[model samples]
Target: MDRGTTDRTLLSPERRRADRTRLIDGVVDVLVIGGGVTGAGAALDAASRGLSVGLLEARDWAAGTSSRSSKLIHGGLRYLEQLAFPLVHEALQERSRLVTTIAPHLVRPLPFLLPLTSPVWQRAYYGAGVALYDALGAALTADRGVPTHRHLSRRAALAEFPGLRRDAIRGAIRYWDAQVDDARHTLAVVRTAAGLGAAALSSARVTALLRDGGDDAAPVVGVRVADLTDGSSFVVRARSVVAATGVWSDDVGEMLGDAAPSLRVRASKGVHLVVPRDAIDGGEFARGASGGVATAGGPDEQRPGLILRTPTSVLFVIPWGEQWIVGTTDTPWRLDRDHPAASSADIGYLLGQVNRVLTRPLTPDRIIGVYAGLRPLLAGEADQTSRLSREHAVVTPAPGLVLVAGGKYTTYRVMAADAVDAATEGLPGVPESRTAQLPLVGAHRWNAVKDAAPDLAAAAGLPEDTVARLLQRHGDQVGAVLALAASDPELARPLPGAPAHLAAEVVHAVTAEGALHLDDVLTRRTRVSITTPHRGTESARAVAELMRGVLGWDDERTDREVAHYEARVAAERESQRMPDDRTADAARLGAPDVRAAV
Candidate 1:
């Protein structure tokens, strides 16, 4: 009955080693390499379908592309411009599924405004387009929880959004989409996979693939893994292998020694800048559109992309909890694939675009947070990365190896399903996937429990706001978090510098979420480092203490963690100030991770 407190040691080093041992001893049904949203989803899918699954990641879960998304879970309405109806429809369906069924707490609806430059024709045009978007959602989920689109005159638009530029808009068409905390969502999927009996390991790097039978073997029988935390190497055998690595997909394919499986994948870098809440005054779902509004819906529709005035990007801003997150530039990137640094040009481009329509201009001093994510664009024609398809492709050149590439974040679940389906084709006794109806680790009956939690909130001595925050992050498992605090009341205290997060969360990340280092906790688990002005300095010691018990860190280890964290923050700060990518990359590399002692 208390499945809520499942005693699975998901992130423990000992449990990870034991799981790795199990895979080497008995062949796993599927071995998933990569820990982003798609790979994490694949692990959950395979395990839920009764396949013995082993998932290995070189770094922490969602530490790569998954964590760096624009954090929206919506159908690609822009794809409609390219006449990519199937992709839009599929993404719309997945977005609805995530909000209504899968992880409602983590994903919620956000309203977007398409500011019309011309009232009459544009309103009719965009209204029909958004109507179609709503229709697609209806077809996807008959009772789509989101409201339909609405048209507003210029005067009405300005009245609702006083900060808007008077001349930039003719009117506005507001429509609904969804947003999510990307890293949290990915972490949830990985945890869900572990709960479904998948052996999950982080800080376990896959160095190479070991072919079965011979060098020219038909299927990849196993992978050679190096435990990065310790200097040890081992082999993990599986009946089928899936490479769900995002931007690194092509490189992973290279390891398999086959003619690259014609995946047109390219990495496009997108950046989001986080600013103080004082920078924007608007609700979370506020939206505005521009010139292309009227032409968006017709059969021969082709219009200039409408700008979303997001934090530091277009001045079209929305309230995100405590801060205003702005930006997102869709520019081509040619650089080292992993850890794409935001170039000065990229930042300048965003600032220029966003400042154009803002009543008050934002200078570089206003920036408190900056993150760049790579969109894995399925590559396309000469000089056009934007034109590349967001559609996904799965190719199996060899029997044991499967590669999935090129899909939007909203469609990760769909992409994962397809990847697993292809990879598990030859696996013995693999049951049909049941993930469609299965709830994630923390999500089962969440709504019902959350609806009935006022008494529980009072009993736990938590304010309503605190209870709501806990339920948002932990879903139906808030009771477990409460129990953590019950064992030690200190866990209930808010993190020193980060009032929004509880110390219990930092503890839980280590105990359950596979956060191996302090950076993992600060940067990914809680996001205190990026969102705060001190970048988690004041809270580092507090969080370090929370980790000490779970990770067996001595005083010296804790000091080193804190020192490394400080250096990392300093380096990132320096990186952003640099004038170019070359300088930025160098600045970022100034703080190398402290390697485990030999």
Candidate 2:
């Protein structure tokens, strides 16, 4: 009943404790299972609709597919090939809302170059398609700030990006799409939901679907939860339950003894590589591609991100701050769901595809990071997972239970609205979704904070770029982070090993953001894992030491956390060396999950 607490927006250890107590004690209007983008979005949407909501995550937010996406917020240009026009249009609208209204600080436009290898018909076909794509975006929303598509000559394409081989193509088409730090975006959604009176907690797993009389065929009433963090178990009562569990959707169906799946979600593994900006061409790309700052002016105007048509799916060489993200092999995967390992073969496949256009090839030694994520695709008569629909399905297989599956990263808000609509279909007088107008935690004062960066940097005795990046990552919340740095002189300096991030940020991740472990802070909260060459290994112990006091960890616990992280990195390295998925899965499983049994 009391929603006026200052700690509501802070996902601190204290808040987690309080929310867990509240979850155990009270019956909520809606209970959401999952903490990825869609689940977090649903929580924010439902809470803003004036519902008492409970959000539970078996792990940290976006720990799975959400964090490991291609990180693009677009209408899926390739979907046009499938003629999924309505899906494209809906995604375009959501993309506009994210850029202009909801998360300008987090989501902004980035340009891309689509090379035409066969100059004549290829140019006409792709040029027309791209023109339609741009027109669709413009028609849906007035000037989303994404530039219109432009035709480029062979010479002009080389001028824009010299990464392509000289003899590779005839010309190119340049267009715009948005990019985001997906993990942070998901965390912001969670915080925004918490601020709106949703009791959100992570590292909490639902072991069973609770029934009133404990009958197998009885309608679901609540859940039996296991706290993965502390090894405690509890019960939760809710009027309705929504499973946005993604690839794990079928597991939810099994809990209710439902033989039929409302939404058949097949796991399609998408593997990506993070390499230095120079790796594309090695020399010319180093000079041009690393030009722009992230989340602000965007990646280099001349050296736009590349979209190459693979024999299977589209491949992207998207530019980040100092690195380039080259990715995504979409093949059916039937391996471990928690950690989808990228095998040497997957790596070879991606490298082999991107190398078709590159003047200089990418080698394993040049890779900074490797990650794999499973896409929850709707099962269809089509054999290939790529042929599966991007549109989501929501259904109530049993009374008081809702399952949502099969959607992409860009349209999570829409998916959330639909899931909430289905979950509360019988509940009278529930208001329509208010999330379209709502901005996440850092979005509110982002514009003003961005403009004040130089002054804020000077005042804080930090570099302008550092301040700007902080503003970009935390949005209006930069002030809170700055306050932490000002309080202690020692925390103001750059972190050891990972100089791009401040020492204060490691502290803030726990105190304000809901970072329960080293993995949460380094991997999701800051992206130290993917950006740094050592993949957060060199920075592990130091980060743990910074968080030790805040998390009340003794020397043993601190050392254990560091050990788990190092082991995780080592296991990932071994996995990447493996030639196939089964071997990679076994290698990755060498290091057990940091979380204990429930």
TM-score of 2: 0.96
Per-prediction TM-score? 0.91, 0.96
Per-residue lDDT of model 2, residues 510-541, tens digit only: 98889989999889998889888889999999
Off by over 4 Å in 1: 9-14, 213-217, 283-318, 593-598
**Which of the numbered candidates is closest to the native, going by highest lDDT?**
2
- Model 2 has a clash total of 0
Model 1 lDDT at residue 182:
85
What is the per-residue lDDT of model 1 for residues 298-348, given as tens digits with 9 covering 90 to 100? 212221112463432233344455666676776677676656777677678
lDDT comparing candidate 1 with the true structure: 0.75
Which portions of model 2 miss their true places by more than 4 Å? 1-7, 214-217, 259-262, 281-302
